[model samples]
Target chain A: MSAAAAKAKRAVRRPVSIASFAQSENVRRDDQHNEVEMLMPVVAEVFANIGITKNDIDFICSGSSDYLIGGPFSFVTALDAVGVWPPMPESHTEMDGAWALYEAWVLLQEGEIDAALVYSFGRSSPGNLNEILALQLDPYYLAPLWPDPVSVAALQARALIDAGKGSEEDFAAIASRSRKDALSNPKAQVAHDIPVETLLRDEYVVSPLRRHTLPPITDGAAAMVLAAGDKAREWSDKPVWITGFDHRIETHSLGGRDLTSSPSTAKAADVAGVADGPIDVAELHAPFAHQEIILKEALGLDDGVTINPSGGALAANPIMSAGLIRIGEAAARIASGQAARAVAHATSGPCLQQNLVCVLEGE
Target chain B: MSGQTTAEDLGPVTTLATPIRLDFEFTPGVAQSRFLRGLEKGRFVGQRCPTCGKVYVPSRGSCPTDGVPTTEDVDLANVGTVTTYCVVNVPFAGQSIEIPYICAQVLLDGADISFMGLIQQIPTDEIRMGLRVEAVWVEPEELTPSLASVRYFRPSGEPDADYETYKDYL
Candidate 1:
C-alpha cells in the first residue's frame, strides 16, 4: 500500500480508551430518584474515578428517549445532572448510550478532543413500556396493531425455533446462565440461580419465551468517560483500548427480512474486526434470551468465549442505557485482568435491526 | 393508456391527526417531594447547593450548575419580584383564566432561581419587571402535596424590587 493510503487507514483506527465507567444500581422501580438525581452520583463517580471533573471533559453526549418520559426535550433537563453551565460542546441521541459513545469515538478519532463524557438514563417502570415501544413501529400499519415488545420478540423466538436455529430449551439455558452469573453483579436488578428445568416448567408469557427469558423492567442510568492517548494513560494504568468500533443497521421492515438471523450484527462484527484475535469475553445487549443465541451466531463467537459475565440485559434492561452498559461491562473485564481481549455488542430497534460492536484490548 | 390523476380529480387530504396518550406514574424524587410537601403547608421552600450555595426552589433534586445535591433547606418568603413576564393575550386550549392574563417568572427572596407563577389581580399592562407579588394559596382544606395548593400570585402591595436585585435571575 502507498504511504499516504496507510496514513489514511491509521487515522480511521485511532485508539480511544474507556477511562472510567459507573452505573446506578439496577432496580425494578426507582421511586426515590428521578432521572437527574439517578444520574448525579453516577456521573460524579465516573469523573471521580479518573480524578477529573466536568471541566476536564472536552465534550458531552447523552442518550435518552422522549417517549420514555412522556415529554419532549427530556435530555435537556437531564443535563442538569452534569452541571453543564457556561455552555459546552454537547450532543444527544434518541437511541441507546452505545450510539452516543460511538459519536464521541468518532470525534476523538478526528483528534479534536481529548476526552468526552457519555451517559444514558431510562425508567421503564413509569410507563407501559410494551405500548411505548410499539410507537416505534410503522405508524401506518404495525403501530395501529399495537404489538407489544414481548409479543414481537416472541415472533422472532418462534422463527428461530422453526428455522432450526435454536429451541425453547436453548432460550431457557441462556436465561438460566445469565441470571446465575448476575448473582455476583451488585448492579444487576434480577439475579437468580434457578435451573433451566424449573424455568422451562413456568408458563410462557408469550410462546417460546417464558417469564425467565424476558428482561427485568429496570429504571437506571450509566455514565462513561473516554480519553485518547496521553489522557487515557493519565486516567488509568490499564486503559481498555477500543481497537475497533463500528455499527450497522438493517431495514426497519420486520417482515421483509429474516428474523432468525442478525445480518446487521454480522456486518458490524466484520467491520469491527471481532474475529481478528481471541475474544476472552463478550458482553451482549440481548434483552430477550433467544436474541443472545442469534447474536452469538451472528458475531461468530465460539465455545471458548465467555458471554455476559455481568448477566447481560436479561438481568436488567433499562432501555437506552443497557446497550452502553454492555460496553462498560466488557471494558471493565479487560481493565480488571479477567480478560485480555473482549468484544461488546449493543442492539436497537425491533428484532436487532441495529447493531454496534466494539473490540477492546488491554496490554 | 396511463394511470394519471389531476389535482382537480383528488380532493384535498392534507392532514391526518393521530392523538396519542401514554400514562406515567411520576415520582417527584426526594428533592421535589420535600418542596411539594412545603407547598402543602403554605410555605415556599428552596434547597441550597453545597458547592455554589445557590438556592433552587422546588429543587429538581440538584443544582443545575454544580450537579450536586442541594441538601440544605431554606424557608423562603412568599413575596418576590417578577423578573420577566408575558401577557397571554391569545387564548389557548385548557386555559381557564381570562384572556390578557399575566404569567411571570417569580424570583423568591434568597432564592437564586425563578419559578413560573400566574400573576393575578393586576392589569396586564401594569405587569412590569420587578413588580412585587405574593402567592395566593387555595382553601386550607384543599391543601395537598402539590403546587396546585398555591392558586396564583397577586400584587403583594409591597414596593417594586430594584432591578439590580434580580438582574442575574433575568
Candidate 2:
C-alpha cells in the first residue's frame, strides 16, 4: 500500500441501481391544491405501480427547502403523505430530489436494505422564487441587495455573451427546440413550436435572459423507487439500473468562480461517467435557456444525444422538484424500453452551484 | 369587503418566519478537538503535518491533505491578510452585523487554509482585496468556545496590494 493508503481506512463501495420512478404533470401552477395534496397522487401512484405499501419501504428520504415553503422545517409537514405514524426510518436533505436519491443509494450501499422510496416537492407559485433565493447569499454583505435568481442568472448570461461563447438568438433556439420536442410529451406544461425569431421578440426579465429562457413558476412533486441486485430483477421486465452516479458543489459566492463555465457540472459528469459510451437520451435540468448550452458543453454531449424530450425545467420549474423530474423522465424512457441507456442531471443553489448526475440503463 | 389580509389576497400567504439562530455546540471531532480547545485557552495554535510540513491555522488535528492526525502544535500570530471580499448589501438571519458591512476571507499568517470573518476598522466602501488585517481577539475572561471569540479583522496599516496577490485565493 502507498503511504497515504496506510493511514486511510479501506472505503466500502458497491452498486445500487434504480428500479422505478414516477412524477406528476409539469403544471404551470397548481393553484387549487397545496403542496401536500399535489404530492400525494405522485407517491400513491408509485406505491401502486410497484405493488408496495409505506410499510414495505425499508427507508424513506426526501429533498426540499424551507425557503420555498416560507416556514422553518417545512419538510416536517411533508411526512403526512408518508404516513409516519409507525415512524419509518427517514432523513431529509435540503437539496434537489436527486440528492435524496444519492442518500438512498448510499443507504443501499450499506448492503442491508432491498428497497427505498425517495421523493421531493415544492410550490414556487406561493412565493416569488427569484426573490426567495436572495436568502442564499452571504448574510451581511451581498444578500441585502436582494439579488433575485433571474438577475444572477442574467449576470451569468451577460458574462457568457461577453465571452463570445453564444448569443440571445442561441438561447431562443434552445427554447424553440425544447418546446418542439416537448410537443409530443403529454405531461409537458409549456410546450410550443413558436419560431425562434418570435421568441427573440419577447421582453427580457433581466437583460440577456428573456422570459422564454426562464422556467415557468410551478408547483409539483415526484418520487423514485430504487432496488438493487435480485430485487431489481423482480421490479419489472425491464429495470433501469443506475450504472453511475456522482455530484459536486462549487463555492456559494458567485463572484468566486467562473460564471461562464460550470466546473461543478463538468466534474460531476466525469465522475458519473456521462462520456463512457453511447447515451441514448440526456435530460438536463437547466432552468435558464442559456444554461442548457453551458450544461450541454460541460456534460460533453454530441448532436446525436437527445436533450430533454420532456420540456424540462424551462417548461415548468417547480423549484425543488424540477431537477428530480429529469431523473424520472430519463428512467421512464428506459423502463418503457424506448431507450437502452439514459443520463439525468439535477442542479441546485444560485447559478447552478451544485449538480448531481446519474446514468440509467436497461439490461 | 374582504377586510382581512387573508390567503386569497396575498396569493398563498405564509406565517411570518424570521431569522432564527440555530446554535449548537458542535463538539469538534477528534480531528478538531485540540484546535478548539486551544481557542478556549486564548492561544492561537496551528497543526503541522509531519509528512507534508504544511500548517493549518484555526488548527485542525488531522492534516486535511495527509488525512492523518497532526502531532506537533505550532503557535501562530493573530494577524492575517484580507484575501478577497464583497460588500454585504443585505442582512441575513443569525447575522450579528448591520447592512453595508464587509465579509472577507482571511488567510492567516503561516497557514495554508483560509477562514471567513467580518472586516472592521475600515469603511465598507474602502475595503479591497489583499488588505492587510489583524484579528481583534476578544477579552480573555469573556472568551467562549465559539468562533465569535475573534471580534473581527481590523486594518493593519499595510499598503494596498495587487489582485494577483490574492486572485487565485478565491
Identify the leading candidate in terms of TM-score: 1
Q: Write the per-residue lDDT of candidate 1 for residues B22-119, one digit (tens) a residue.
A: 89888788889899999889999899999988999989888888788878889999898999999888987898988888889999988999999999
Residue B25 Cα positional deviation in candidate 2, in Å, after optimal superposition: 35
Model 1 clash pairs are none
What Cα-based lDDT does every candidate model obtain?
0.91, 0.78
| TM-score per candidate, chains pooled | 0.95, 0.66
How well does candidate 1 match the true structure in TM-score terms?
Answer: 0.95
Which pairs clash in the backbone of model 2?
A141-B88, A141-B89, A144-B90
Candidate 1 displacement at residue A121 in angstroms: 0.4
User: What tens-digit string does per-residue lDDT give for candidate 2 at A112-168?
Assistant: 888899999887766666567787876655676777888999999999999998899
Docking class of 1: medium
Per-residue lDDT of candidate 1, residues A1-363 (tens digit):
775664344344578999999999888888898788989999999999989999999999999998987877889999999888778999999999999999999999889999999999998888899889999987866887889999999999999999999998899999999999999999998998999899999998998889998999999999999999789989999888998888999887888889999888998887777877899999999999999989999999998999999999998998899999999999999999999999999989988989999999999
Candidate 2's DockQ? 0.01
Model 1 ranges off by over 4 Å: A1-12, B1-19
User: Top lDDT: which candidate number?
Assistant: 1
